[model samples]
Target: MRKLFATAFSLWAATAAQAENCQIIGNQTLCDDGVSGQRIGNTTYWNDGSSSQQVGRFTYNSDGTSSQQIGNHTYYSDGTSSQTIGTTTYFSDGRSCRRIGNQISCD
Candidate 1:
């Protein structure tokens, strides 16, 4: 159907636009949309840089274990979200998570 085709094209175009901003710098691909991912030395890292502080990292180590953090702007499947303005994550259950500045509160 024409409507289905248009909807699919719109989704694909949006995704392509989001992916096109990254630039290959050395081993890193840096994007204007607050994400940078690269292999730095022996470690692989992805970071969020929505603000000057750029507050999170997912890193892979040579030993096979990995470490990660969520910050800057994070969104949950429940439509809760976080960013420099702080964040809220809601669960399908009654529980919720919230962060304001450096403080985190959950229920």
Candidate 2:
């Protein structure tokens, strides 16, 4: 039971860390991970200090790699992806975060 509790805590901490880096400041959602986005109509335009180009729903990185969001699924350039089903966003890394009100809780 202790092991399970520890594991749960770790996952919670990871999710908290990710959520802490992100904030809803005015009209933009900003993150310390070098990504910020603003929704315009049906598309969310992302800026990472390099570009603000919106091709479909993908955000291109400065490294020539890009990440795209289709429906609720996000495809990253690193071959990893995440999907949002309901109020939760599940990462390819096995982490899942749930949106609670204006905050995110993960486990």
Candidate 3:
């Protein structure tokens, strides 16, 4: 009887630990302590643990596309983003580029 009780307690403890480790919502996993950040669909949400500070949010689209947002800046999956200079076009394979005249070339 004592051995059975010990085994049951151990099993319960292990199950509780696993439950507290991580949580899955939709296609994302959210850590309880916020150390792993929150995932939504194909995107992940991260914060600096500051209410007034800006954080990065990434979203991956189904059509081989993704996006990143930080503060007022928005980045696309093609490695491009909206900058103060102008609209930047990035290659599909993660290469940086800038629009020169009317064409997009690597920067």
> Who wins the TM-score comparison?
2
Lowest summed lDDT across 10 adjacent residues in model 3 is found at 4-13
Any runs in candidate 3 off by more than 4 Å, and if so which?
A: 1-56, 83-107
The sequence of per-residue lDDT tens digits that candidate 3 reaches over residues 1-107 is 11110111110001111213333344333335443333343234434331111223544333345455555344554554532234342223343333333222232
Each candidate structure's TM-score, on Cα atoms with residue i matched to residue i, is 0.25, 0.51, 0.25
Model 2, residue pairs in steric clash: none
lDDT of 1: 0.31
* C-alpha lDDT of all candidate models, in order: 0.31, 0.46, 0.31
Weakest ten-residue segment in model 1 by summed lDDT: 4-13
lDDT of 1 by residue, 3-106 (tens): 11111111000112112233445655444554555544433355532111111343322333332235543333224333333254433333444434433334
Model 2 is weakest, by summed lDDT over 10 consecutive residues, at 1-10
Highest lDDT scorer: 2
Better of 2 and 3 by TM-score: 2
Assess the local accuracy of residue 50 in candidate 3 as a C-alpha lDDT between 0 and 100. 13
The TM-score, computed over Cα atoms with residue i paired to residue i, of candidate 3 is 0.25
Preferred candidate (TM-score higher): 1 or 2 = 2
